[model samples]
Target: MLTKMGKKGSSCIIFSIMLISSFFSISISSEQMIDDYRGFSDSNNSFANFTSAGSSTVAISGEPAHVGDEMIASILVSNVGSNNGVANLIIENLEDGISHSGSPVEISPGSSREVKAPITSQEQGSVSYRWWISSNGSHVNASLSGEFSVEVLPRQTISTYLESYDWSPSEGLVLDASLFLSSGASRPLLLDIFISKDDGPLNHLQEYTIEMDPGRRNLQIFLGNPSADSVFVELSPIEWSPNPTSLNYSTLTVNSPSADPSLLDIECTVSSLEPTSGESVRMKVNLTNNDNFQSPSGKLRIVLSSDQSILAESVIPPINPGVSVSYEMVIQSWPDSEIVQLEIIWSSEESSSSVFLSVQSSVRDDGFALPFDISSALLGALSGIVIVLTGRLVWRATSSRTPSTSESGIRKTRIEREEHSANVQTREIDCPFCEQRLSIPAEHDGNARCPSCSMQFNVAKMGETTSSIDEKPEAIENEIPMSFSTDDILECPGCDQTLRVPIEKRPVQSRCPVCKLEFLAEKG
Candidate 1:
């Protein structure tokens, strides 16, 4: 019993010591959890305590805060904490039509820094914005926020003009301009001047920087000598007061001196100023040289000015000093009235002379009028009648003198009969030696010589075939000569007149002189 009681007591003591150690460990764990929560609360308190030196102030500098004016907003930030901090500015709630620009910065404790942001607005009114400055330290984070407002003014009105301009051979071109401002400006303005010669490209002449009070102001500019027939000047604004509405530009133009007059004189005359339509117009032109020393040669042109058509042109002959020349031209008049120009041009001397003529409208007369001269027409009719009568008389005299029997006519008939008889007795043949065609009497049958080849060959008789020839000779048939006495007579079939023909010229054609009728006088 003593041994058992001692073992039980030792076990109970060991178990009691284990329970106390467990209680101590649980107490230490609860204390550590409380300390951790306190440390977190202290960190949050540090952030809440961060503050600006005296509520960061904002100021606008440079030009006045007007619409289209670029003004700077200087934000003064002071760090009053005990440690250094990094500060970043954020724009939070900016109104419409307003803009700003800036970046982050680092600040030290007890030192103030100015952060500048450029602000501009395209509208006029109360413009407002909210800004926040976030600062970060080694052990804490801090932030400061505020709101700012400014009144933006409206834009100004302006006008400009080019008053006058002058030019000289030695001084070049000088321009005068005027400017009018409706109200005062807070900044300087820039103006540019440009000039163009003879419708050419614009050239920069001068520039002006203006700083003036409200109202009109005058300015003068000088441009060096430029060779041109005409000068054009313009005034353009480069930069002016903020958003000012004004004219774009003003301009002025000036012309150079006139050229000298020509030394040629022209005189022209027209036949009829108001002629009928479709009628021809006659013009006489006379040109004279007015210069006593120069002899000029060129071209003379007549131009229809309404349509610029060249009606007539001629080369002008050289004219001596103080000499004159004349020309005549005829042209069809236009269907309507118009002005025409006559020009004389000399290319060598570069001189010209011109004169204008006005052609009046066509005139019509509603009456009976003769198109030709009355006396000349009567004389022409009389002359035609006399010529016709003379021709008739000559023809009657010639017909009455024709002879009843003409010896020459009989002789001509006899000769024609002989030629016909000769032709009838001949026949064409080809030479065997040279194949040349020849005409010979049909009765001749012997050796014949070829005229072209000078060679002799036998001729074949009529109606006979030759050994050397491939074709038979042509035959003459029904040909017989007639014989008659010297007292033979024949009656003409046309007029019944008796004609005596010679006996040797038998079967001849004989003509009767009474009716000019011909008939054959044969032996039968």
Candidate 2:
């Protein structure tokens, strides 16, 4: 019974000691847990703080985005806390007209990640953004925000012009450009100017970046010593960044300077406006230089084209300034119903000019005379002479039948009778050119010209006239063979005018009626 009581006391004492030790361990663990939570709550701001180097990395592309323009905002985030988990990033407070989107990030401990969001605007105003980061899946608030600008600037436009349409090598080209912007605020812009020759590769002429304000901006640029057949200029904006969709451009053409505009004048005329088949097409061109002091000389070339094919050409005599010269060229002859183009080009070593003439075709089935035929034309002219002779004979027969009514009438009748008698006795001759008969009036007895042909001849031959028919027949028979032959056709060297020299008057010095210049005529 004593042993049993001792064992029970020992077991009771061990149980009591174990229970006291367990109570103290529970109290210590509870205090440690409370202190850890207090520390986490107190340092929440410091736990989510970004590093100083990374804080300045809130960069935005397209600093000044216009309305309807898209902008991008980029940032770098680091897990400053010593915990690694998925982080929930929420962006808010963007303007009503601006919107953005991004994805949640999984950040490692003490590491960083880049976040990008696309922002687009639909209205004009200041734009702002606010971002919140939840670290380690905790909902404690950690935030960052930024703001930018958006505007509705006026529509940008550009235009250009030239000083003169015609230019010379000595006189360069002047180009003027205008830029317009109606916005009150100043804006920066870029421009590129290009120039080329003969539709070749374009070369840089000028580049500019300017601040455009309200109203218009004018710029002038001159191109000197341009040595090419053609020049073209273009101006446009360089949109390196996201910019306004309103783009503008200007284009200009500068042809090679051909001639001095003040000194050169050209005129062209077609010989036959209504041309026919199987005949040469003739064109006359006159070139004149009005400059009094400067004497210019160059070659004149003429090119005729039909159906896009060149037909014939002509070379003009060299001309000088203040001097006028004319040239005739037989370009081409084709059946009617074809369009003809005559291009006359006058060029020197440093100057040139081009002129074009177009003629409409008019050909008939039955051909007509070659423009100037005096033979058939004279028949219609003889009808008037015949009518005049018939009226004179009727007047004489009526006057002889009726008695004179007054003294003036009787005097006129006597004069008419005497004139009629003399006309009947006088002789008539045939014209060599038109072959029309002309009567020689007694009043004009010296070197007389046939009114029908305008050919000058002497009627007084040693006091003997055509009334001596017996002797005149012998003289006429001998002289008829020397009147017409192939030697009569002659061209004047000075003015290119055709002249007819009677075969009897061969080996003679004659004065050209067209040019009035003298030249010796010899039998061919």
Candidate 3:
């Protein structure tokens, strides 16, 4: 009996090794995997085999799928070994380039239950995975390979301008994107998505992932706070694929309507009275969302200026979807002087939406101011009136005149005396530079500064100062010098005596010969 038992045991050992080589490490199609078989046949030494049994994973969700969205994949592994030891299963490698981070464990003798792993990663692509099943120690083992791909789609596209919307964004804003399948296909595509907020006190939202089918889809995005900031934002949807496959993506952003706050359909106005030159006189601004997206609750910020200055601002908060909101504010019109953009910022508890509003500035009417300015017509009327008055005075003087020899002689003498007086006065005019009333000898010699204001005036060759800048002094003097004389007076600081210099031999002031004090020469 002992001999017989030994023979049977040896035979069994040989059979086990052969069976393990053929069945323990077998590969097959996805449909062939069974919950009871553990995807392979078990030998006497075989530890675990998987059997497909449990809730399957869902794929192909749309864009803007909420945060923490889950994608679960499940399979069961059982121990076919005779021992009643614990069977530990671990994901050693994944197929389609998928990386699994979680461990699913089970004990075995007969069979272990199904295990599900919740996959979370922003990485897009095919999820390829394989697992190692050890029944007792590391001695008996088995493995199964599986592959699944996920796809994310693009967001819907809007026109360049809001056709008939109520509120318009000050800046064009893009929204978060939706997921899609290829063909915009279904299931088969993997994606990891991340969302973030920018500028204006908002932090980016959390990260999320999902599986999609195939095809085209939209990703929603939005602008930052309309009143406070103007920033570019991103909502990234990344996808990956295994070898022997290619991926597709959309390069265009989901556009918003042109930002025009005046189109907000609200009653907003500006009346700053003495408005700054560069600032825009903002009026009523309105905004309306055509897609009627799910938006947060907050003041509908309408930027008065593309730079977003708060001028005569009014906030319209809690605007609902499919409804209109209004805002009014004045902005520096000089830089933002043109009707550039209007921003409709809607905020909420979870997320926000920014709509672009196209704008056109208010048309101004300056008809009332025309009369006060120098109009050509006014100058023409004045000229005509002056001609009429002068003609009337000349006619009366000529008609009343009577010829007389004695009167003519007296008039001639008086005229001659008047001419002499005028000449004497002109010659006696003092010089402004020397503080002596003088005639304007020639004209401005060269560029000089007024002693009072230190203002440099370029004296044209015509002897007149350019009146564009400096104002005239209080007292007037028609001072004219026949020639500029630089040799007025001089003294040597080194000595206590004065020296005389000619106009041509004018000595440059250096060390005074009398007192040793240094003096710089003046450009006379």
| lDDT of candidate 2 over 364-457, digit per residue (tens) | 6665656766546654555564567568767754543323223354345678877766555455665544557776544444444446544444
> Which ranges in model 1 have alpha carbons more than 4 Å from their true place?
1-55, 81-84, 91-94, 97-101, 136-144, 212-214, 228-245, 257-524
TM-score of every model? 0.41, 0.37, 0.24
Q: Write the per-residue lDDT of candidate 3 for residues 345-371, one digit (tens) a residue.
A: 443334445555554444344467554
RMSD of candidate 3 to the truth, in angstroms, is 26.2
TM-score of 2: 0.37
Better of 1 and 3 by TM-score: 1
Tens digits of lDDT, candidate 1, 1-524: 53676988778877888899999999999999999999987775443223455545556675556576666766667766566666655553375634354666666766877766667677788878776665554332243566777777787656677778776645656767777665635346667766675588887766777775667888777765443434343334334344445663677776432212266677778777665655777778887766533344566666655433345556776565467788887766534343334333232234557777666656454488789996698558666855675686677555433232222544556788678566657889987756889987787776565678665556668989765654433322212222234443345667654444544677775545445343456775
lDDT at residue 363 of model 3 (Cα atoms): 34
How far residue 268's Cα lies from its native spot in candidate 1, in Å, is 36
Best by TM-score: 1
lDDT of 2 at 179: 68
Q: How many clashing residue pairs appear in each of the predictions shown?
A: 1, 1, 136
Q: Considering only N, C-alpha and C atoms within 3 Å, which residue pairs clash in candidate 2?
A: 258-352
lDDT score of model 3? Answer: 0.41
